[model samples]
Target: MDKIINSPYNINAVARVDSDNIVHNHIYHYCPIGRVDDNNFIYDNNNNVVGRVDDDGIVHNHSINNSPIGKVLENGFVIKENALVGRVDGDNLLLAGAAYLLLIQGNR
Candidate 1:
């Protein structure tokens, strides 16, 4: 495992696989300077970010080989896999398959 501090606000870390030459994992940690409120972005052996842990401690995984599965909003909502979910006004909810649920509603 090799650690590299790319910037003051982010840390880029990588770990190599012993068996496969092309297999490696890259981690991107944000806001590692002061606050412990950091997020982890994980990549697969193919250099593709397959998952991410948000600041809210929600783990978002890829559907298929770096494909977006879902995201965790600031609010406490576990949007399960293959579900039409979104957020509105800081609230995360299911889109009901008819309406477009806003994942992150801006302060408007």
Candidate 2:
């Protein structure tokens, strides 16, 4: 089953996918960039390393530091710093799904 990541305000759809969104407006599909590691990497449709999400819900840029950019809390709240940024509708959303909303869609 696919999960739709809605805007924090609950107005627009940030992402619609199970692992990657396929909507026509969505130019990029968020998916696992490589082999599953300690941190799951998020890649765009073009296959570039976009960011990563850790088991603890820490979202990181594609860098060695994996600096904290945002977080996907256990309650399905997507946070940037300390602000509520997005929300996932439905359960069991994979790390990549949350990462795309915060790291990619949030920027748009």
Candidate 3:
């Protein structure tokens, strides 16, 4: 979790995945991406637990009132109840059929 703070690799905020968004040297195209706290927990605007990414590259599901919504494996495979849901792309975005951004909706 501490690595997230001093992330040697910067995961810069990007413009929303939209065609209108130009994929050039656009500097303003940024979203208030969620923060990974010291405790390694991500929360939504409603103060609801969203998810977590630990030092092991394991993304733990903390959604559903902090219940086990699912887990995103290091390989980006989302598993829920031992079933494969979907996978996360290079952009760290999941394309699950029932996908919902586990992060907060807007700027927190």
Candidate numbers, best TM-score first, in rank order? 2, 3, 1
How well is each residue in 1-108 modelled by candidate 1, as lDDT tens digits? 222211112332222222211222223222221111113445433454445545453444443454444544444233446442332221222211101011111111
Which regions of candidate 1 deviate over 4 angstroms?
1-39, 64-108
TM-score of each: 0.26, 0.70, 0.36
Q: Model 3 TM-score?
A: 0.36
Clashing pairs in 2: none
Candidate 2 per-residue lDDT over residues 10-51, each given as its tens digit: 657656654443322243433332222234676665666767
Local distance difference test, each candidate: 0.29, 0.63, 0.38
RMSD after CA superposition, every candidate: 16.2, 4.5, 10.8
User: Judged by lDDT relative to the true structure, which candidate is superior, 1 or 3?
Assistant: 3
Total clashing pairs for each candidate:
2, 0, 0
Candidate 3 has its poorest 10 consecutive residues by lDDT at: 1-10
lDDT of 3 by residue, 39-96 (tens): 5465443555466655544445554454445555656555556766444444433322
Tell me which of candidates 1 and 2 scores higher on TM-score.
2
Q: Is candidate 2 or candidate 3 better by TM-score?
A: 2
